[model samples]
Target: MQIPDYMVVPSLVVVVIILLGIAFWARYKTVGPDEAMVVTGSFLGSRNVMSEEKDRKIKIVRGGGAFILPIFQQAEYLSLLSLKLDVSTPEVYTELGVPVLTDGVAIIKIGGSVEDVVTAAEQFMGKPTEALKAEAQEVLEGHLRAILGSMTVEEIYRNRDKFAQEVQAVAAKDLKKMGLQIVSFTIKDVRDKHGYLDALGKPRIATVKRDAEIAEAEAVRDARVQKAKAEQEGQKAELLRDTFIAEAEKEKVLKIASYKREQDMAKAEADQAYFIQEARSKQSVVDEQMKVELVRKDKEIELEAKEILKKERQYDAEVKKRADADRYAVEVSAEADKA
Candidate 1:
């Protein structure tokens, strides 16, 4: 190790290269996507055409790395992300002379364009995020008060979106001076010392509820009427069905009675015919007996003739009685039909 005289120069050269590389690495600065690295002091003039009117020696790098000369240049980061500011203004008089208190929030951020970045660098290059937020909030509050003074409490309460727009319109000009932009402006609350908005809405709410109740009652009434009509229709249909059934039953009964009456008449006619045939045979037998008696004795023949006449009269009377009975049955059937 002590005999390396020729390697000394090469060793020193390698050490110098390594040291230079370390220095270069140390001067290399990077800016994240959410931030802009502002390099100032002894930098070349700005390349932005919009900033040509003003002489500013600064450079801004975003989402990339840049080489910074340690002795001549300094780097600062300005967040590109939005910053939220809460604004609460004292009681301000509206056009209608009503005192109103307003609370709101604003979202703002540094402009990302070349001109905007140059302007932001000039105004807030070394400032913290809070300082930018305070500046934006102050501008927003002042414009909010001015807008509120031109609107009534009712307008501020009802047209909250318009109120926010008006405030943003007025405040944006002031913020643009500092190279800031308003992303959103919102009215969180607007109130008065007295209960004005609540009193204004009470009657409207009551009217809406009353109208709803009336509509509900009308619906219920209509439902009841429809139900009653349906019940009536059902009853009418049932009554009609029962009437039809009763009429059908009456016709059936009439048909059955008529059939029975016809059967009875046929049976009666058959019985009458058989009775007449039997009477004729008895009369013939009586005649033969009388002839035999006449041959035996004249006195016996007279008595037998008288007996035969009596039997004939009795048969006639029995036929007449049966005919009267049949007529009576016919009359009763006619009366039943009429009834």
Candidate 2:
């Protein structure tokens, strides 16, 4: 039984076409940055993935290649990008019972673990990107309110380091719940309750005022004591100087009087000695005149006695011659011879 020749050639051509179709089915795929892999056809809802992460443990499907069951495998991309969250704090009561209003910015991004993708998938599965962003804003407000309200205003100012630490602790916990990890939670401004700072400053000002008054009083007392002591010392010095001057003047006067008295006594003694010497000289001249008068009286008495003796001698010679002449006849010759 030989078949027709046209039927045999057409059958060979149909077999080659079937083999080419099978080869084409083994290799066609597409992957992008923002999409995650999804199982299709026979591998639907399974761990098979086609992603840019080549070393990923999840099943990988290559680009531009045909998978065995593409209908059971698929990829849905999710964005991994940074976001900004504006945190606005309510006028909440602080630990010191003061109402405060605060506001700041929060920086957040996706977590590092594969659980991060798993967590994002759960919350925002069917939701849009804007809805997820709004949820992040609400979380920022809640974390700031809980952390900032626990501190007083003075403590916050003195210990901003501690405030930042507490914010990190609170944000890390709450952001995890919101499918976010905080890069930073910064407080930009804090508006305090009305008139509370002024109240605290009043007591410290009064204490400074009291100290100033005490210092002023002590200075005044020290000045008055010093002035009184200076006056007393000046008066004492003046009196001592006057007493010394008067003593010196009295001594000078006494010395002058004693010198005058000594000179007067010396003059009087010199005059008395001169008068006694003149009287002794006059008495010696009078005694010499009395001796001369006694010598002249002795000379006169001796001359009168010599004259009587001469006259008696002459009379005796004449009487003897007359008797001799009368007796001349008998003894005149003898009398003349005896004469």
Model 1 per-residue lDDT tens digits across residues 39-129: 7767535442232334646677878888888878888888889988999999899999988899998889888886677788788877887
lDDT of 2 by residue, 1-339 (tens): 776997898878888898777755654445444443322333433343323344332343322233445454444445556777777777878887888787777777656445565556557756787787788878777766776677887776556667766777776776686556888777777776696655655676798889889888988888888888888888888888888888888888888888888888888887787777777777777777767767766666676667676666777777777766667745756777788
- Clashes (candidate 1): 0
Model 1: per-residue Cα lDDT at residue 289 = 91
Tell me model 2's lDDT, rounded to 2 decimals: 0.67
Give me candidate 1's TM-score against the actual structure. Answer: 0.60
| Cα lDDT, all candidates | 0.84, 0.67
TM-score, per-candidate, Cα-based: 0.60, 0.43
Model 2: how far residue 321 lies from native, Å: 99
- Candidate 2 global TM-score: 0.43
Task: Name the runs in model 2 displaced over 4 angstroms.
Answer: 1-69, 193-339
The deviation in Å at residue 79 for candidate 2 is: 0.7
